[model samples]
Target chain A: MGGSTDSGSQNRLGRRLLTERVSGYWLQGAGYFAIVLFALIVLALLYQSLPLLSEYSLVQMLTSSNWDPAQNQFGFLPAIVGTVYVTALTMIMGTPIAILAAIYIAEYAEGRTKTLVSSFIDVLAAIPSVIFGLVALIVVVPFVGDYLAPAVGSSATGLGIFTVSLVMAIVVTPFMISLSVESLEALPDELRESSLGVGATKWETIRIVLLRAAGPGIFSAVLLGFGRVFGATIVPAMLIGGQTHLPSSPFATGQTLPTLIVNDFGELMSLPLTQSALIFVGLMLIVVVWLFNFSAMILRQRLQQRWQF
Target chain B: MDRYTEQRLFGLLARGAAALVVAVMVLVISVTIYRGGRVFLMDPTIVITPPGSRYMLEGDGGFLHAVLGSIFIVGPATIISAVLAVSTAIYLQSDYSSERFSDTVNMFLNVLWGTPPIVYGVFVLTVIIAIGARTSMFFGIVAIAIFQYPIMTRYTDEALRSAPDSVKEATYGLGATRFETALMTARAALPGVIAGIVMGFARGIGDAATVLFTAGRSTNMPAGPFDGATTLPVLIFDQAMSFNAEVRSHAYAASFILIIAVLGLILVSKLLAGRYARYAPGGRHS
Candidate 1:
């Protein structure tokens, strides 16, 4: 092999390699910023929450319903249970409608209808959560207090777990539908055509082929929607009546984690343990959200391996 | 029932479900427009005029302060977030990081994106307290920037990933540096990048949770980035909770404007993405 000892070419090659290495390192550094921010946030929440933990056992925080901060009671049991109830109810109410609507959009609806429905979903998703709370306060609260609650063999003041879940269902429906539609649309057309060619009807093709293919994506969509409802602040804060008790029923008023922090935030920041309690609430949200995300990731991976669709 | 009829029934049910969702959206939007529209028609001045003394008590003046505050805090936050998000997205490519590393980074991003905005509020509030600083537009911007970063990055990353790989290859084949190659590929994904920025801006301006404790509501006009200022969402939140008829009406009015702005931005993002798609390779769309 003939080697060219040209100094200029060698210098240029060296410079190019140097540029490559430097830029790669710089880009990786930028990419790591997300991790850095995540660590800082978790650390900050944990560190600030230490004071409250020092005062009360973790079990007491999770089990007791006594939340009178005036008496130094800071039980988080109600908030945890309320969040679970609201989120579960919201998913139960919203998911079926969203998934079916998404199926219509991705499989049945065509041309103008598809575009219009998608645009509606996007706009709905983009609406501020505060407005959702505002509208619910004005409209649904009165209706529930006057009619819906009385008809259900229960008396109510309208703001309760039920109302919060209903409004939150509406708030999260569009988001879930948007994601579900995206997943369904991502399936290869061949999956549909092959099923159809094999004597499968349109619905049959979608049920067997497209749905199976897009299962993990749709699952994650629901998971993400769950996260949205779990962390929702304004709707529950305004409509859940802020009773701060363990929810007696769907018609009974109570506070979730986010609403607890929001309702308690204004004047309570002055008290040190109270401040830690609130920050601890924030920490709980972060921890739970992380759990959801990690579980979603792992489950998606496992589903992908199993489905092989 | 036979399979054909059963399929037909299922199709009808799905269509009904779709109709229900559509009906819900329409009901919400129309309700908003009806309630908030009347306020605007009665007094367009409310959106334009600044708050006077006893704005919440008397409902005598407009919410110009919130309008300006939203602009001041979110505008700069969007710009900063766009740069960081795009860079982070570009760096997630094979040129900069391995697949495993990028995947880990993405998990972090997803968690951040999923974290409640209130947590960001709490974290930033803790910072403000630790630093002995008042709730101000400065911290508001910082909180919003942090909140928007992951959202924008995720969108930008998806856009870049979906770009035609041929464009990337040709750039590298032309002896371009990785940075230059990234710039070329980024331009190829320009429509999506711009859409991401617009979405982040919309989210930043529309969110109350991130700025609720950090921005601190005020009737006074914005003094500076360091001063406490209120945004439209925050104003609506306070107004709705004030339990006064007049204040509630203002909340409806303020929200009407906010909804219009957000919806308009969503439309603009769609139009811009569509328009710009035609200029990029393999990105053309109707």
Candidate 2:
């Protein structure tokens, strides 16, 4: 009986509810806009890359090592090779050091030391990649040019694939250490204590038990590091010496995908074929990074499942 | 080797590697300070000059213009990203979106997070050029907003997801609408959201690639958002690459400023995140 007298209040409540519903949908649409933007990025890169197909076959572009903008020859072999070589060298140098440090922090360090080491690593992670480039340009290049290249019997400038790899190693190490530390810390206490109970040394426990159990997680971390190294632009742009030739040695100057794009993009904009070829390099970078990230995600999910079990 | 000997060797190696990491960090910071310290000790004028000065080999130059330019570009980019990221996070956490759709969106965001900033520069550059727009601060902001979006969204999403379910249920039990519930949840996670925004801003401000092509380099200060300007990172890159010693010294000075700003923001964001954790239900005690 009282409800009939409150019809105006009921209408107001209904209007309020309707407004909330509309706002909810609008927010959802805004959320979806991020995904839409991602799709647009991929699509735009693909569209820009399409013009290269008419001039050069995909195989030719990927296999041939020529990349002269003036001659209109746009082979991406050297850049691709250079990227792989630099990333591989970075992984080789960075992975072992990072994993070892992560193990020490997660398994060996005590309270105060643990906090100090972890915070230091976090600070290292937060340092911008460009600063690493600056340091490499000033310090690493001279050291390599004056010392390392001479010892290696190479007549090469310091700004080459080796310096780029060293810079990438520094940049990617913190990421690797952080991820590996998380994985190592996630191991059960019982697993470690039991190993110690068996009269196993601490190193034995870590090597025979912890590392085996945390292998996938560590691998995922390595993959993430690899992905990071592959996508790095500024360091390579500054240190790789801007040569678009097949990298013959660690000391030889070369160009990576990112460095090539950054170095030639301004000039390439005037040439359609070369510009499309550069865009194609961008697409290749996306694909390579996607593969690394997807694998890392899959491995991480597997590790989680194993932990749950 | 005996077990004890092997363990000793292994432990030494591991400890040595850990120490090596610390040494590397010290080396990087010390080198930066040593080189970047010259501008302060020898040429204080380089960093203190007014805007609109020429940063040339024979001119009295400073990084005021680029420093101001970085601030102008990053401030709006961070605000735009924070709004979009928070809204998106709220939507995903609410019942307005399905789990499947949310998962897909998150996957896309992850990929976007991994996509290189240069690719973003290329994409935004192409679009801007197609629209007949010149390289300016506006394009820089847009590109950086896109670059920071995934990072902020991920952080905000994690914050929203970690919101205590009991709190959400209580709000709904009081007859609150979904939007109201989401807003309340976001409010409760404000520290984490702010931390995310701060981190994203730090990242956006420090990045050189995203603005390399979009924000055309100019020595003069940016007059407005539509005007062209140079940022600290880009200026560092350009000046370092030049064949002049004076220009290279200026680049070091700019790098010093950029590093200080970035590292400071990162420290602040970390502190904010720690504060957020303390407020979170079941979080570890400080």
Candidate 3:
């Protein structure tokens, strides 16, 4: 009887252990569910967008500049060009200033000053994109309309690609500063000391040795900033003035892919083909932004590996 | 060139660039304050009244409904996201997962994080339509939650991974189940988890793109998750785009309030992270 009772208790314990292991498996499965959801989102977008291929040839849809939804002719060239132009302009305007600020914070500023500057960048990062749009609408637009546009021999409505790009530059500067600061800070102090010991000036050391070592990280930061600028909808949508045609100048109004979706999505739903075309825009955004993000991640991973070795 | 000249020139350029950034930030804040401050100077009633109130030519309207709507949408969404994110973090950091799997998960999360919020809005809009549901706070909450999920999960995973392995081993040696071990690990990483949740909440509240199409705009305060609601960001967007000068000024006022709330949240998260740093093993070196 004693042996039988002992065996019964052992069986119960075994069942309990088995139940516990099963619960653990369930938990891990739940974790993987996020990945499943992401894949589903991608698939849904692709499925919705595939119909556009039948309506318009891929080359015609992508290359043609005319986009008249009322006439059933849909083209994405204008928005595509606007997106590329605005993102490029933002990088050109923002990157150098951000790098300089980051260098000052990472290499030059001491205790209190460093903390203050870093906090400023953090605060900038935390500000809402809508707020940036609103402020730009009030301040930057009027300035461009009144002063800069006229100076450049363009009519000054102040709602144009250039105005949008300027706001975008400001919006993305904080991200660049923070990322570049991390890359700069991650460099070894030994390198700086050796450079100085070898009779190199501080500026020369930073320009040559420190920057070269941190190049991959800094490049990744710029790529991340590009991704951010590309994905941004609210700021550009609010400021870009919703023009569908190709811009004649930086001072001319334009639309980006995200802005196109945001501005016309409500009306586009009534037209099935136009809705599908909008889905294609969303798909394009996903593709471009994902590439930038993936490349940045890879570069950062490689940098980490280098440091580990 | 002489070393002194080169150093001086570089220093000058750096300072000038840094100052420019500072100037830009200052300019933005000052412009908003100057313009938004007008609402207070003219009629404080406009700033205090609930949405759907009568609009006078002199800017007599309030955004209380938008403020409340934002809270209603973000509060439950943040809670839902936090629960999912913490669960995912706990499971992924457990011994059942492999390094390769973790890396893959991280890569997926990075991609998700980089996705435009507008795309999320579009995706949710399609889902809502297919299900025959109207645009409402429920849809908005779901959309924002989706956007916050990867962010919260990534941060929480970092925190959980920082938990010392010895503590985990001790729990396992005591005959604790994997679930119990995860619970213990979560307790140790509570501060970081809280910080992550707060960060996600801030991002969700500040975001306009994700909710733009999912949540139909309503003038009245949100009745429930099913009711159409308008948020502060959406309100700002609508008002800023209006042709009327008074409405534009009102948008600036709304922007100021939103800015204050978001900045406060960021500050709190920073303080919380700092407070919990000592408990994290990685915190010691940093």
- What TM-score quantifies how close candidate 1 is to the native fold? 0.95
Best by lDDT: 1
Please give, for residues A132-161, the per-residue lDDT of candidate 2 as tens digits: 898888789999999999997987669899
Q: Summarize candidate 3's per-residue lDDT along B1-286 as a digit string, tens digits.
A: 7888999999889888888998999888777777777665676676568755543233445777788889888888998888888878887874768888877887788788788898998888878766889999999899999999988998899878877887698889998877777887876786778778887888899899989888887777678879899888988888887767877778877887787788789878878777876665455422
lDDT for A176 (candidate 2): 92
Model 3: pairs clashing at backbone N, Cα or C within 3 Å: none
Which pairs of residues have clashing backbones in candidate 2?
none
- Error (Å) of candidate 3 at residue A10 is 11
Worst 10 residues of 1 chain A by lDDT: A1-10
Report residue B6 deviation for candidate 2 (angstroms): 3.3
Worst 10 residues of 1 chain B by lDDT: B277-286
Clash number for candidate 2: 0
Off by over 4 Å in 1: A1-26
Q: Candidate 2 docking category?
A: medium
lDDT of 3 by residue, A227-283 (tens): 889989999998988989999899889999999998887677688888888888888
Worst 10 residues of 3 chain B by lDDT: B51-60
Better of 2 and 3 by TM-score: 2
Q: What class would a CAPRI assessor give candidate 1's docking?
A: medium
Alpha carbon lDDT at B38, candidate 2: 66
Model 1 agreement with the true structure over A135-251: per-residue lDDT tens digits: 888788999988999998899989899999999999998899999999899888888888999999888887877877899999999999999999998788889988888888888
